[model samples]
Target: MKKMRERTRLIIQLAFAALTNGYVSGFLGQKLYKGKLKQFCLPGLNCYSCPGALGSCPIGALQAVAGDRSFSFSFYVMGCLVMLGALIGRLVCGFLCPFGLVQDLMYKIPVPKVLRKIPGDRYLRFLKYIILVLMVLVLPDRVTNIIGQGDPWFCKWICPSGTLLGGVPQVLSTPALQASLGFLFSWKMGILILVLALSSVNYRPFCKYLCPLGAIYGLCNPVSLYHLEVDKEKCTRCGACSRACGMGVDVPKAPNSPECIRCGKCASVCPHDALQFRFVHRKKEKHGQAENIEN
Candidate 1:
């Protein structure tokens, strides 16, 4: 049953990845679609500049709006992110993000993996929030050139997804892009290579320490509509759930930790079936019913 559930999730992840990058014609022809769908942002981290990508990336869109001279804030991008986060939190990261899928696949490679946490791992998790605030938001919004325009710092400097899906593909396809490549492109490529190398050893180092999109969704995890519920009555304190968790969540104590991606591994591995993926408001509904009956 656990295997079945995990297989289902894997299928969903693959489907989302394929669907978001389904422009096979563009991919084959080495062209990008400048279509209406590109106006809207995807729930996960997919690069809009990718030859096959059909929709815009939320983080990229947010940065674009922030850096735009005409716009001070991106109501559309922020609203979409907030709505999705409120609905499912980091479930999007688990099931929809193409980059997350890539990282997961990288970890599956048969190698001597480093499964243990390093020193200050807990403190390092906060780095994503700092990246989100400074690179994703502040720099793009505040730092401008002589013409009052700023660059998408995160996309330009940090996003390995863009380097993998957009920059690499575009450069390979266009000889002109290769000729124009300079220090910045080389730096981004170096970062991508480093991330790929680290991902083979560590499980989702980017998600844990650098993904600004994950940081945003993580902030909503505590109050998200969908979350993991721990049944204290059935819990035996065996710590199986925690052991099964890939994201290092202490299930019994912090089942709803912002780091949890709602991957359901904890619930699937629980021998007592003490953990559940459920709507947060369902408990409120039950409480309201009990109060009405008492009245």
Candidate 2:
């Protein structure tokens, strides 16, 4: 039953992504409105340069601010993401992000190899923080040009999502863009290629170590309205949930750990039915109170 639910969730997520990208809307509307339906934006990290993309990407919006130096905070886009993350945590990453969904599907290619496990050092995970502070935020603004202009460092130098969905496709489709590719384009494209190749073996290297959006959303997970709980009384500590987790969360220890993407895989795999995916804002427990009060 749980497996069925998981598959259903996956299908629904994929369907939503497909429909919102204007793929379906564009195709259907072309018959009536002469390609006028290509003006919407989905809630996830979809490439604006994608032929099917109806709206701008959130990361791209952030990059525009960091890159322009003259721009202000993207209130509309940032508000949307914050509201979504606060409500769902990284459930968006696990279930909704198109790029994440693509990576998850790629890892299912059924190669005969052991799962790639990173060292379990809690500190090493801070690398994403460093990336966010330096690469995503600091570098772009610091490297200002003579005109006091900055560039979107991550989008120009790193972003695999842009490279895969925007850069590659646009370059392929438009001869003008292809002819203008410089050494930077090659460099970014190379990184994207490497990531795509590695994604087949590793689950989500982008989300784990690079994605600034993932980092931001992950911070909200520990206290987000939506969370996963393990009823310790029912849990046997069998580690089944942990073993089944794709995000490498120690389910028995901290099911709502920041590293958890709230994918529900662990909860679904729990045999004792001790795990639950529910909405709960975690609160401080009083010194001696055993009551599980909903705060």
Candidate 3:
């Protein structure tokens, strides 16, 4: 079964999420983890404030530097993300992101999928890039508090992952935090509800249309060492691969498309057995016989 083929990937997702958020005592005690492990960043979009999070989110760490009073840069965070992306592209989205797992589970609910086949979805995919540049990058550095420290704009304003996994848990645990919840928390909750609702009808709506971290990984798809390859001679121009792609990637045409999450669905459904993932090493091939799909 198609689902069975993806079981390994699903298990990886669950495992990585659990590993990054393994502070059981923090959850039990209603305290966010503040150990030395929190100094390092997780490769996926796990919430930093989640009571059980043992590591900080890379996106949140980047924003902390970007929004600092000194406007310091975060080579550590950026380098970490780049290193991970270079190793496997957005495989992080497919097999590590906590929010991605949430969306995947939501999609299992029986419902009419109203958003997957919608028009102009391709255009919407670009929204994440805009958010990466504006909310994550520009606003955080440009907008500062009275003391000149900037807020983590994306975390404060738009990250549903933070709202659901971090904000909700923190508020529920700490009575004082609950009392301090204001319009910002309400806004974040609304966004979280909307994102969850959309996830039930769309595969990874947040990853496709809103995740800044995904946008960064997507860019690294072209240069990632791990990639999908196609044997052009074996291909019959059939569209089975594309059809299996929940991300709507035109596999064979663009096997390494930024939108590809490394879900491996396209490869699994290739009737010709023409598709496969490969590392940098490769045998010499005849011209035009087969190649890695271009951007």
Candidate 4:
């Protein structure tokens, strides 16, 4: 059953990836899709610079609005993202993101996993929120040049997704881009390589510890309409759900934990049928906390 759920999730991930990046001619021409559809935002973290991307990435769009000329806030970007997040929360990370699919595929490579859980992982999880604040929010608003145009700090300096999906392909396919490649490209490439290596050993390292988009969606998990509900009456408190969770969420105890991606592994593994994803919250009893087995 767990395998079936995983397979289904994989299919959804692929479908979303294709739907967002379906522009074949863009890749053929080695140029980004300069289309009208780029006006909109995708629910997951995709690269705006990806040659085939049909729509703007939410984080990229948000940063652009925050940092560009007017330097004003964008209700359009924020409102759209928040509304999408309210519907499914970090389910975007689990089954919709392009880079997430890459990480999932990398983790499947049999390499005798060396780092399933990072040391001090609980502290490490806080890194994404810090990136969200400093790189995404703070730096974009504060740091600017004479014209007062702030660069997209997160995309330029941090996002492995852009490096992989955009930088690599664009550089490889375009001679002008290749000639113009400098330290920034090398730096992002290093980050992408490091992330790929880590993904082979750790499941969704970027999603778990680096993605600002995940951090935003995670914040919505507690109040999202689609959320996990643990049936206290049915739960045996065996820690089965926690054991099965790839994101290290202690499911029975904190069903709507901010870190949860709603991957449904907990739902698939709950032996007593204790945990499930619900559209509406049901009655939950106060109970003993489940230890984070994977953490």
Residue-by-residue lDDT tens digits, candidate 4, 147-223: 88777899999899999888888888888878998899889989999999999998889899999999999898889
The lDDT per prediction is 0.87, 0.72, 0.87, 0.86
lDDT of model 4, residue 170:
85
Residue pairs of candidate 1 with colliding backbone atoms:
none
Off by over 4 Å in 4: 283-295
lDDT (Cα, tens digit) per residue for candidate 3, span 1-295: 4678789888888888888888999889977777798889888899888888989988898989998887566788889899999999998899989999999999989999877864778798899999998888888888888988888989999999999889888888889988898999999999999999989998888999999999999999978999988877677889999988888888888889999999898888888888878886466446644343332
- The deviation in Å at residue 136 for candidate 2 is 2.5
Residue 25 displacement (Å), model 2: 9.2
> Which parts of model 1 are misplaced by more than 4 Å?
284-295
Tens digit of per-residue lDDT, candidate 1, span 151-170:
89999999999999899899
Model 2 Cα RMSD, Å? 4.0
For model 4, what is the alpha-carbon lDDT of residue 185? 88
Off by over 4 Å in 2: 23-42, 72-76, 119-124, 281-295
State the displacement of the C-alpha of residue 144, model 3, in Å, after optimal TM-score superposition: 0.9
Model 4, residue 121: displacement in angstroms? 1.1
TM-score of 4: 0.94
**lDDT of the structure predicted as candidate 2:** 0.72
The estimated TM-scores of all candidates read: 0.94, 0.85, 0.95, 0.94
**Residues 1-295 of candidate 2: C-alpha lDDT, one tens digit per residue:** 7679778878977886776565544343322123444333355667666656766677776656666757544555567778877888888788778888878877878885354765653565787777766766676667788976677776777788888776776677668877899998989879887877767887787788778778878888777788887676678889998888767788877766778887778878788998887785445467533233221
Range of the 10 consecutive residues with the lowest summed lDDT in candidate 2? 25-34
Which scores greater on lDDT, model 1 or model 4?
1
